[model samples]
Target chain A: MFWRETYIVFRRQLRMALRNPAWVIIGLVQPILYLVLFGPLLEPIAGQLGAQNAYTLFVPGLLVQLGLFGALFAGFGLIAEWRAGVIEAERVTPASRTALLLGRILRDVLQLFVQGIVLIGLAFLFGLTGSILGMVFGLILTVLLGAACAAASNALALTTKSEDVMAPVLNSIALPVLLLSGILLPMTIGPQWLQVVSDFMPTKYIVNAIRELFTGDFFTITTMWGVIWTIVLFAAGLYVGTRTFRKENA
Target chain B: MIHARGLARTFAGRGRGKEKEEVKAVAGVDIDVEKGEIVGFLGPNGAGKTTTLRMLTTLLKPTAGTATVAGFDVATQSQEVRRSIGYVSQSGSTSPEARAGEEIMDHGMLYGISQKQAEARGRELFEQLDLDGLWTREPRAMSGGQRRRLDIAMGLVHDPTLVFLDEPTTGLDPQARANLWTHISDLRVRLGSTVFLTTHYLDEADALCDRILVIDHGSIVASDTPDALKRQISGDLVELVVTDAAQAGAAAELLARIADTGVDTDTTSVSARVRGAGHEIPGLIRALDAASIELESIEVRRPTLDDVFLTLTGRSLREDA
Candidate 1:
């Protein structure tokens, strides 16, 4: 029954997203623009600096950026629903609280998966090719990371109860994670303290995991650690988000 | 079908730095609704009618009290209570994106109806509520009355034993309100669903409800059948419609001299509460004639629920904002 309700909510969210075609176009356009402009600008510098597969390096960073953006927008959807009175309507229904939270997080995961696939296709066009198995691993990692960030965003949204608060809160967290998670630069080149701080950021793990997969260096223990971090972040996000959501509803 | 005693709810004030003050939305109150009966809960704004309904429906917890809905305790057996009762809030429940038929079916499915059975029940209710032709249309495309009827249809699609309607007809026009009353009466007769409804319209209670509970300031002040309530204030209502303000005042003074009775005067009319209206009419007319006040029209009628409400509460049922 819970799965059924979750699926129903998922379908509803997809339909609503599809209805606003401009948002989809806008969301898709941003990362594609970054991929087109930044990919070539950094290619020569990366190779001259002895970075392995400059295009491949850029792919993971773009994917992490897109994941964070997708997760932040997903949180905005919750605030919009509250303002529209849809959340209150759903609360009075018999839908399980757990299912509602799961459905929202899964929708974010799916959105991030779409964004990741589009970026990967762009990477292929730019002469960045990887094993099919490697691409599949990259996609899975992107979804897990997206789900974690989305869950955290939802937790913040529920606690604050205002979209004005949500927008700034997401930007403050997301921008720093994007800048410091070795998305645009390798941790080896960054300051030592910055590298240590990146160790605690979930996006850093995602970027590392995706980077290793694309370079065919997938057997490293860092990859396993990245997956473990993804799992831990996902679980923590779900726990905190669901608890706050239930409290807000109550 | 429903019983509540000592029910109370308090909401803590907002923000971190502010003192934690609790506003009692619902004070200690007791109510009972029997099977297959329509009970109208009458109250003005801020009278705690909606708050009490929310608690009984399990949407809000009572800070103090014990209550059972459909034989299930509201506190501990909330799920069971929720399953057995349907709640139609003051805010309409129809989603703008959902078509009427689909919305009803979704609610039925959530209540555990099988796919086949839910579709069948949805169709039955749609036709019964005269919404068969509009089933394919979304709520945004429908009229207010159509949407309100669809809301009622969705609530009944689950076949709950009891239903709570909070100001169900507040936004509806007269014709739509009448149509909703017809549907409500049919539900009682066909499905035997006990209805616990709240409304500000006294005539609605008189025409539809088997009993009425008048609440004020978080307390129930009066409870009885509409007729019994009106009889409690048994007296004659004498309405003297005059031509101008001067004549109205003169008529009021004449009626005052005739008897020590309750009197109310408006811009162009004077009304008096008198015992034995037939006998008092001649004396009243003679007094008015002596005062040189010309009466354009006079009406003598039995007390109505409005008068009963006024007598019990010292306030009009329809409050002016």
Candidate 2:
């Protein structure tokens, strides 16, 4: 019954997403621009970072960046859904409340996957090189990070319940994530204190894991921490988002 | 179809310090709705109409009450209650970007109906709700009235035995509201679905409801048929426009004799509520003529649900809403 309801809700969310897909591509634009305008600048410093080229290093970071920013602001849409009475409408039904949140999280993860593929496709044109398996692993990490962020974002949206509150809160969280996670530059190049602080950030571990995976390095401590953090974040997000949806359902 | 006793909900205190006091939104109200009865849950804003509706629909749990909607306990068997009833909230639930027909289909499926069955029922509802050629139309693109009709279609798509509508026509224009009323009335005639609707519109209660339940301050004030409730008020409202403003006081004295309510003299007008105004107006005109007082016009209006509310609550429903 739970899976059946999730599939029904998933189909509904997908249909709505497909109706005006311009937003999906629009969401990808920011990551693409960063890849195009900012990536070549990293090539000169690529040797210092111990990569074959800047594309390998920068592309993984951009994928992580996309995963974080792309999914982090999803609360805005959730707030719109809340105000539009979609949640209340669903609550009145016999549909599973957990299915509702899981279904939307699945939709968000699918969107993140597509955007990651698009970002990787453009990076290949910019002289990127990596083992196929490693790149796939890297993309998986990006998507996992996205699933976690999307779920957390939705939970935040349900809690705040208004765009005005959601906007500033997301903004405050977004700045630290974008700057501290080293999505643009490796934290190894930053101060020791900065690196220590970034260590506490979830995206920092996922970024480090994806960067290493792209270089065909998988069985390392960094990658292990990355997988663990990603799972923890996803679990935490699912827990909170489901709680919020269930509370609201009651 | 719906039975509730001492159905009450109390929200915990939100205010801080000395101001913190739990608010009883619905204070032990008993409600019994028969099958196929189009019952109007009439109340002004903040009168616990929506709160009671939510409790009955299982969206809200009552602090001190029991409600069995469609023969299922609201608290323990909520899923069963939800399956047996359709709820249309005041905001009109539909994703703005989703196609109208698909939205209905999805809602039906959520009720555990088959996709094929949902499609058949959805198309029929679209036709019934006057939403032809809007199968693929997005709700955001539809007009206000059309959106509301789509909401109704979604609710009925599951074909539940009971329907709960919370202020269904709150934001609709008169024509659209009246059009929706016909569709609502048709529900019981065609499908035998009992409707329990909440509304602040007195005319809607009179025109659409078989019975009206007036709620005030979290309690049921009165419950009866519209005509019966109106009869509780003393008489029809009568207003006399005297040609000479100076004769208003004299007219008031004469009008007071026939009035069951107090007569008011306002410049050239003397108005009061007169029982059986049809016979009394003729006598009133003759008395005015014998007194050599010229009259411009006399208006008589039958007692309405508003007057019923006024007599029951000591406050006009219109001003409160």
Candidate 3:
């Protein structure tokens, strides 16, 4: 019954998403620009990952980049929905609060996945190469990260209930996480202290794991840690999102 | 179908420095609503009408006391209470991206209605609310009235036994308000659905509500049928507006002789509660004229819910909103 209710909300969100083409168009412009403009600049750093082509080494970071940035702003849609009285309207229904959060979180994941695919397609155009299995794992990791970030973003959005507060706070946290996650560059090339700092960041392991997968190296500690961290982030995000939702209803 | 005893809500003040007072949004409100009855909750700004409605709808927990809606405790069996009621809040759902019919149908689906049943119910509601030809148009393209009707339809799609409308006609034009009132009245007549509504419009309450609950300062000041409440304020109200503002006091005193109840005065007008004020208007005019007060207008006004509120709280309902 809960999943049924979630599906109903998910379908509504899906219709809303389909009706608004601008979200996808706008969401795609940033990561595509990074791929187009920044991918070539990382060629010198390719040797650090023992890769011949820089695009393969850099594309994995961009996949997570798409998810991180995409999911970080997912709460904007929810904030708008709240302002429209959609969230308040749902409060009167028999639908479970968990379903409400799950429905929206799933939609955000789907949206981020679409954006991830577009980024990957652009990566292929930019000469990124990898095993089919690696690409599949890469997509799954992006989606997991997106789900976690989007869930956290939604929890904060509901907590603050104001976009003015949400934006600056998310930016402050997102930029630091982005830099430390090594989304734009390999953290290993930086100073030993910087690498140590990056180790504390969860997305850093996912990035390293994906980079290893891109090189067709499946049997590595980096890949295992990446999976563990991504799963942890996923579980943590779902827990917080669901708890905040139930709390709001209460 | 609805009963509340000492239902109250309080919000703690923000800040740790100094003693910050907590705000009591709804303070000890008690109400009883029978099945298939239409009850209107009338109150001034910050009078806790919405807070009471939220508590009844299980959206907000009362800080004190208890209530049962649809035979289920609002605090405990909230899910059963929710399943048995429909709510249309003041700030309605106007999704700019969704077509009107689809919005209602989707809302019904959320409550576990099948698509076919939801569509049928949506169409019926569309016909009932005069929302035809809006199935294909997004709310952004519709007028405020159309969107509000859609909001009502969304609430009704599940066919609940009771409905709560919190200031449903607010922000609507007069014609739209009238149209919505017709549909609301029809809800009780056609479906036997109990309606608990909150409105700022006194005439709307007088015309539709079987009983009106007047709340001021977090307490229910009065609750009765409109005519019963109005009759408590004595006879018809005589509103005398004179040209000479200075003579208002003297005019009120003169009218007070014939009036059975108290006389009220403003800058240039005197309103006296009198038995048979319509028949006594000639005497009132002569007495005011003898006092050298030039009459601008003399209106024999019947006792309204506003007068009942004014007599009870020394405040006008129109000014309260």
The numbered model that scores best in TM-score is 2
The lDDT-based order of candidates, best leading, equals: 2, 3, 1
Task: Tell me the deviation in Å of residue B57 in model 3.
Answer: 1.5
Off by over 4 Å in 1: A15-22, A48-50, A79-93, A152-165, A182-200, A245-249, B228-248, B251-321
On residues B113-132, what C-alpha lDDT tens digit does candidate 2 reach at each position?
99999999999999988999
What order do candidates take by DockQ, descending?
2, 3, 1
Q: Give the per-residue Cα lDDT of candidate 1 at B100.
A: 72
Find the 10 residues in a row with the least total lDDT in model 1 chain A: A83-92
lDDT leader: 2
Of 1 and 2, which scores higher on DockQ?
Answer: 2
Which has the better DockQ: candidate 2, or candidate 3? 2
True contacts kept of each: 0.08, 0.76, 0.71
lDDT of 2 by residue, A64-167 (tens): 88788878887788778777788888999999898988889888889989898888888889888887788899998888888888888888888878888878
- Candidate 3: where are CA atoms >4 Å away? A48-50, A248-250, B16-21, B234-307, B314-321
Please say which candidate is ahead in lDDT: 1 or 2.
2
Q: How much is the lDDT of residue A34 in candidate 3?
A: 84
Segments of candidate 2 deviating more than 4 angstroms: A248-250, B16-19, B236-244, B250-258, B274-306, B316-321
What does the i-RMS of model 3 come to? 1.4
**Across residues B28-126, which tens digit of lDDT does each residue of candidate 3 receive?**
999999999999998766789999999999998889999999999999999999889999988777578778877888789888899999999999899
Q: Pick the candidate with the highest DockQ.
A: 2
Q: What are the lDDT figures for the candidates, one per model?
A: 0.79, 0.88, 0.86
